[model samples]
Target: MSIPVGDVTGVEFDRNTAFLRHTFLGLFFLLLSLVLTVGIVAAVYLGQVETRTDIAFAGFFGLFAVGGWNVTYGLLSRSNREVIDVYITTEERTHVLCGELADAEFVDACAELVDSDLPTTNRNPKLEAELE
Candidate 1:
């Protein structure tokens, strides 16, 4: 089903109950990678790694370094815009991103039509026809 645009419940954004959670999982991942990279550097600097066998850490450090770069690039490239998530609640909930529909006003009219309690559509056919 299409996510109704505008406020289906006519509530202020601060009072809007639809946003159930805010995610920062990427931040956690980025921090974890950074910590690992720091640990590897410290081990080398503190003379904890000396033998030819310690050459393995060079590979580990390189892997984590690339992962951190990818995360940084993604964070830098993300757009600054309001996004709508259309979702279904279930044992494992589903989320669908609704992009660019912010410009669609017909969706708001449909939501208002469905929410109306009065017989405005039946009483005034012209307004109803225009909305449809």
Candidate 2:
């Protein structure tokens, strides 16, 4: 299937690897909390402790904290910003496109005004004539 081209000038791409942290950390903490809750409840049940309300309340709060952590971690780790790979066009010159024009402009101003001395790599299809 072909990807649809939109009115966007250039598409930025960033992988969703950030979610992996959430998955691993979330599961680990969730399991840990579950085990602890089970142990606590078992102890309370077997010990003939009269503090049934306290044990129940503590277990409920613990589960809520664990569940909340998992949800928040997953959401916060999700990448909202996409990184630009390159500017796609038929233009001859490198456009040096940037998301923040002011930031680029400020850096450009402070940069030494000198022509690039990069040797044209022969592998570049568009610069074949220039390379030759």
Candidate 3:
């Protein structure tokens, strides 16, 4: 089930910008996350998480708070360059997903691929000039 790195042929992407705005729902998540983060911090400050189980619960709260924070950022950010998907096409004509890379670096590199080989000397995966 392994496609050698050298077998990659092309790259393609999918994007959805619906949540890339400061909408009411987005703001709600932002505010809710603040409360979650504060409660955990307060508990830690008061030494309420001394027990293993209490600490686990605190960690759980912190994880959700972080997830909410990330979603809020995505909603509030107006950057047009954010991409929702990027994947590669192997020489065997099968698609292989490439996780998100820094948008600018990925785009700039893709623009430069310009009909180059699968592994450019720098080994950047070739991507289409534009993400669709």
Pairs of colliding residues, candidate 1: none
Task: Please provide, for model 3 over 28-120, each residue's C-alpha lDDT reduced to its tens digit, 9 standing for 90 to 100.
Answer: 999999999999999999988898999999999999999999988877776433343545667567554332335666555545443555542
Model 1 poorest ten-residue lDDT run:
11-20
Candidate 2 Cα RMSD after full superposition onto the native fold (Å) = 13.8
Q: Candidate 2: deviation at residue 77, Å?
A: 18
TM-score of each: 0.44, 0.32, 0.45
Give the per-residue lDDT digits (tens) of candidate 2, residues 1-132: 122233223322222233234455566666665776676667677874458787677667667766766665665466443222223222233333323222454224212111123221222233222212
Between prediction 1 and prediction 3, the one with superior TM-score is 3
Pick the TM-score winner: 3
Clashes of 1: 0
TM-score of 3: 0.45
Ranking by lDDT: 3, 1, 2
Off by over 4 Å in 1: 1-23, 75-77, 80-99, 105-132
